[model samples]
Target: MPQQELFNNIYQTHYDKVHRLCKGYFNGHEGMAADATQEIFLKVWQHLDGFRGEAKLSTWLYRIAVNTCLLQLRKPATTKEIKTEQLPDVVAEEYNPVTDERLKKMYGCIQQLDETGKMIILMVLEGVEYSAIAEVVGSTEETLRVRIHRIKKQLSTCVQL
Candidate 1:
């Protein structure tokens, strides 16, 4: 396949997942997530030629997305919070004030986690497989399982408080 077509196919296939990943990193700031998603694809375009198929394309793309988000978060200028009332249609449709409050607290707790923990939990929430998540996170599946258990326990305790 031509390089452009390949890139387009990959982008189309992975854009929503990458966007969601960014959304998690940004605490649901849609604009920043979208910006990071664009930056991720730009890096993908630049690096696609060098990809040697050693890992699944999605995994490679996710690694780039994670790194991009981490880099963006490290910048001092990106630290401010932006509030927006927009919620996903599903969330809005099913909204209860109590549920919304709980969800907000959960997200806040998630944000307080260490960077690696945040990434792992986000990927888990996204329904990425344990093996795939381990690969992306550079951990053994056994280790990830243990870490995820601890992370979940921590979140549960934090949310309940």
Candidate 2:
């Protein structure tokens, strides 16, 4: 199959999952997630020819998504204030996750986790197989399981508040 066709198939199959993973990293900021998702695909398109078949395609795509989000998060904020009298559209959208206290606490707890824990839990929430997640995060399956159990324990105590 042609690269374009293959990429389309991959994007269609995985876009929502990748977007959700990015959103998780950002504690559900839609605009940031959308930006990271776009950056991830651009990288994928640029490097598509270089993808070796050693890992599952979804696993590889997820690795790119995670890295892109981390890079975006690490960059110093370049946003400037607009002197508009109106609130931002993101605020007006009214469907944000932060609207729910429980969920907001959950995202806060996730953000407080170590980088690997955040990546692991985000991928797990995306319903990526444990094996695939383990591969992307570079942990053995058994170690991943143990880490997940510990993360769940930690998050539960935090979120129950």
Candidate 3:
């Protein structure tokens, strides 16, 4: 397939999830996520021709997204400063596992965690599997399970009060 078509396919397939992933990383800072998402796709477009088929496409896209988010976090203002000019005109919305009702509080609580804990729980919130999260975060599956359990309890308590 041509590079443009391949990129278009990948973007269409991954955009919503990728955008959500970036949004989560930015603590619901939609503008920052929007910028990072664009940068991620640009990188994907530039590099798609060399994809080796060794990893799942989603995995590859996520790797790019996580890296992009991490890079964005390293910048001066941080995700907190890059707020959206306006909120979405939501008539109403329900929070699912992915869109946790407590997401803002959760993210705030997550900010208080150590880097490793934050990574673990962030992946869990994103609904990434324990095994994949372990691979990405460089921990054992058992270790992640323990960490996630603790993290969830901690966030729940924090959110409740």
Clashes of each: 0, 0, 0
Candidate 1 per-residue lDDT over residues 1-161, each given as its tens digit: 99999999999988888888898898877788999999999999999999999988878888899999999988888356665666753546555889767867887898999999999998888888888889999999999999999999999999999
> Cα lDDT of all candidates, in order?
0.89, 0.88, 0.77
Ordered list by lDDT, greatest first? 1, 2, 3
* lDDT tens readout by residue for model 2, 66-107: 899999999998996454543333545465555566777888
TM-score of each: 0.88, 0.88, 0.76
Q: What lDDT score is found at residue 112 in candidate 3?
A: 76
lDDT of 3 at 95: 32
lDDT, candidate 3, 22-77, per-residue tens: 77777777778899999999989888877898767767777788888888888897
Which residue pairs collide in model 2, if any? none
